[model samples]
Target: MQDATPSAIRSAGPASLETRLEEAARYALLRRLTPALRHHMIGALQPLGMLAAMLERRSQAPAPDMASITKKSNEMGVLSREATAACVGLVAWITPKTADAVSIADGVKDCLGVLETDLALRGFIAVNEATEATALVARAIMRNVYAAALLAITDAAPGPAEVIMQSRQEGDTQIVSITLKPREAEPMGIGGPSYRALDWEDVEALAKAEGVVLEHSATGAVLRIAP
Candidate 1:
């Protein structure tokens, strides 16, 4: 018998987030672009545009061969990375500062939403429960936003930070660990202390949202959800 279980789908790879964001920005710019200019821009961005459409279509299809899908997915991942790099390069060359600021801001927001949705999909798989999946997805999405906000606040903020989720079917519990490494040590500052303190707060809030009990320790953070 075929295993009916819904296997977890890993993230869309490193470039997935950035690529989606760039695509959003490009689309926004295209919309505002004059017909003549837009035609040229669209031609230049054909590869990225096609890849974006492919991803969207693939996402809607029923699960095909896992191995095949995964292989294609990885290819798409590579394409995403390349697309983002190209987009960044273009952005650097073409200064949009004098352009419509509102459109740019809106594009950024739209891109963020797309990225958040992609991340949430991963989070949903990380947590396998039906009732709590949405909550877990929401928490995951918020974590990304929070991390971004933290980064903006301080360029030197410690990074390579990650949110790790652990689940035990036997105990019917889920634990989410948020690991933080300080960018630099300051003389009695919020760098280390704040990170530690925030972990507990985040865990508790996540627990409440997901109907799970969370715990934190010196090593990392954990969110325990009872089945």
Candidate 2:
């Protein structure tokens, strides 16, 4: 496992401190708005919800349309995975002692487990080989990095995508890099451009809030979270 030794001066690029702050502002607003937005959305979709329920009931009582049953089953399965991951993370965060050296790979694995259903449906693959860890308090930062990379990758490429996360230190600079390598030259069945750059500004905003800086690469899109 990598140690937590890092340079006193952390480096971030493209996004300046001011830009990161703005991002933080937006993120904060979004978080506050999410609950209300979700409630309103559900309220607006009540009719569709009722119709969906009717269809689901019909699908169950009879010999069930295998496709529809499978879809519903898959959705429930995804929810379970998400809930389980969240619980594990919460427990980890609340635990008093977790030994001195923790496995960064384990943390990313939990994050991947949470997104497994969506990644699988999109034909994407996530690989974690991060054999490093910082202090227990910094675990949340690593999770955020994995999550941001996952979102960028999902948008950049279609199914069969590839991502790798690892941690290492260059001299006093402790760096954790999440690299995304799409399977195809051009992303298939996605709305945006096939090979759009990953937005490190977004990640920088999160890092800023968490007290960190990051360097984001436009090509290949490596997110470097300084420790």
The lDDT per prediction is: 0.37, 0.53
What TM-score, over all chains together, does every model reach? 0.25, 0.48
Where's the lowest-lDDT run of ten residues in candidate 2? 93-102
lDDT of 2 by residue, 1-227 (tens): 86544442244444456666646544543443233334434544454456567567968684768787677666666655665555454445323224343345666665665555445545666666664554233555545544555555455543456767676656555566666666763333544322333355555565665565566553244434444
* Model 2 stretches astray by more than 4 angstroms: 1-103, 131-137, 158-160, 184-199, 219-227
Q: Per-residue lDDT of 143-176 in model 1, one digit per residue for the tens?
A: 2322222222222323332223232233444333
lDDT of 2: 0.53
Question: Which residue pairs collide in model 2, if any?
Answer: 122-159, 123-159, 123-160
How many clashes show up per model? 2, 3
